[model samples]
Target: MTNSEWRMTAKRDKVLSVSAPVPPEQSIAWPRGKGRALLPLANNSDETIRLHLRGEDPDSACQFGFSLPGEANKSSGSVTLELSPGQVLSLPVSITPPPPSLLGLAPQTYHFTFTVINLSQKERAWTVMGRLKSKPIIGPGLLGVTGICLIALFVPLYRFIENRENREDAFSATPAAEASEAGALWPLLNRGVEQSAPQTPQLAPPDLESLTYEAMFKEVGAAYNLDWRMLAAMAYQESYLDPMAVGALQEMGLMQIMPATWNVWAPKAGVSDPFDPYSNLQVSATYQVYLREYFSGKGHPGNKWMLAAYNWGPDNALQVIESGADWGDVPLHVRRYVLKIMQTDSHPVLSDPRLQESVGGVRE
Candidate 1:
């Protein structure tokens, strides 16, 4: 009879799927934990038969052996049985039945005698084998597969729940000190000043300056916390303190605020008319305050660093700060600005009476 004609049966419930051709030698996989199957061997005649089982993965690695029923000694009705990984094989003996031993192992009792062998990496095949004397009682082998399926379904969900609970606890227990410690390596804000008050003494306020211009200064100065003279100086620098001035370079109004910078600061300063001297100065001063805070430092020594930075971007000024050098030690352009202001001017334009009035007066 062909190997396919061989009948195998299990006694207990556990078998998943039985593989007929266990690699190397014939054997079957009874998934671990549950299941058993029986292979029938001899029906009538009893002759010694050979069976072998071997592992299919690695070479000369895993193997097992079994003997069939009624093949004791004289009859020689025994088969060499081997076992491996994928399948199990059962072969019948072709000799006469032997007389029962005094030990009382009826021929059927030795129907299956198998041993498991471990395979090495060098081995490529393995098998499980047994000798069948008479019809072998079989057991179920599919239940082992069911247990594996249940494990796969539950493991991920269990880990997910565990991780969520851990994160919640960590968030609740973190203290302010620990939070600060964690953030110490990464600061919330960089420390530095933006601008410094001019070094040379400011020009004396024009005696009996108009109340309208004074009121305008108060409103603009309050919005930006700026020294009014700085705004006045920048206006003089840009438009010669001319409120109605518009530049050839898209600069407009007193202080010559750029449209882009004006848009960014105007809403916050409550200034609607960008060209209005008071409104423009209010926003411009506030914007200068922003730049001052951005560049100034609590430990930075002088206001000159802020001025130098405004004149020559923060990066260049930072080099001076790091070197602990005075503005005069730096570039001439930057030093010339403060120095020129310090030198008193006797020219008619410097003494003009109508300058501040014209720039500071804003309608509405």
Candidate 2:
């Protein structure tokens, strides 16, 4: 069935045969944070057909989700159902927003591939898109906050300046100060203002911390057969890999290793000082090895999950997995942390030249 208001973004090519044929168009776009649309399909074959429904998005901007019509819950990737011969079905799909970022300087579009599969394993696929419109680098809300601060700062300064000017006028224009024993002559007309040299600020020198730990990262990575860039990205997220850095939670050194974590892992890393670069990286690398294996053994293997486990805690990441939800279910901070690590100089979006030479984190 076709509706007057909605446009058909994609359609299955040829009649529905034993082989699943994918659609020609793989990309679709709409202008908003969230979107809802209906995709209609028909089973034209002579026999009853059981079809599989699956949905996923490109790696570049993957903050999207899909659900069947009237479904109570939307799960990640795929769902299953049966369609009788000559039957027609209307599939309803919805997309969620991408991660929050100041990079919303331009419209952000995400693509989700919707596929319908037959028992033959051939499938019909369409790339559905949801667009998030561009936002100002400094939105009105931030501007309003800045304006409020300026008003607070300037209003008092205005009054202060006025009061000083008035006091000076009173002192110079009137003879009361000259007549008083305690007050001396207020010289206004005969005096010239003295100019003084500006004082050099007494700011303390910043700490000298070694930022290059690439060699150590490579050594640890080769030992574990893991990508060194991923470790470097994690290090950047932790403390920008600053060996001398300290966190509010008393997390010390390059990896911002916590006191409790250090106690459990210090002996294994063979180090006493968390501020030592190699020792700190070694401890972190050891912990990451455990994380990687743990997630891989869970049958949900990926760098994203491992990083999420590291940042959000392994138990929390496991809960998300057990819950059968998508990445959207993760908290914003964890999602952001994972996204930053994945995006490198070669990333389709959010790239930097300096991010090159790293082996892996978020692969393109």
Best by lDDT: 2
- Per-residue lDDT of 21-100 in model 2, one digit per residue for the tens? 11111112222234433345667766676677665666634433445545554646567776677876544444454533
Q: Estimate the TM-score for candidate 2.
A: 0.37
Error of 2 at 154 (Å): 88
How does residue 305 of candidate 2 score in lDDT?
Answer: 87
Q: How far does residue 54 in candidate 2 sit from its true spot (Å)?
A: 66
**Candidate 2 segments whose C-alpha is farther than 4 A from its true place:** 1-212, 344-364
Kindly give the stretch of ten consecutive residues in candidate 1 with the minimal lDDT sum: 26-35
Q: Quick one: best TM-score, which candidate?
A: 2
lDDT for residue 121 in candidate 2, whole number 0-100: 34
Instruction: Give me the runs in candidate 1 sitting further than 4 Å from their true place.
Output: 1-211, 222-224, 298-302, 311-330, 340-350, 355-364
How does each model score on lDDT? Answer: 0.40, 0.54
Model 1 lDDT tens row, 1-364: 2333322321111211222211111111111111122232211112222333221212222222222433432222223443333333332212112222222222232223222222222222222343322211232212333344455445544554565577588765345644544453322121111122232222222222254453555545554565445544555565676654555333556666655566566655644444456656666666666556655653554345555554455678777767877556788987765444333343233455544353333321
Error of 1 at 208 (Å): 17
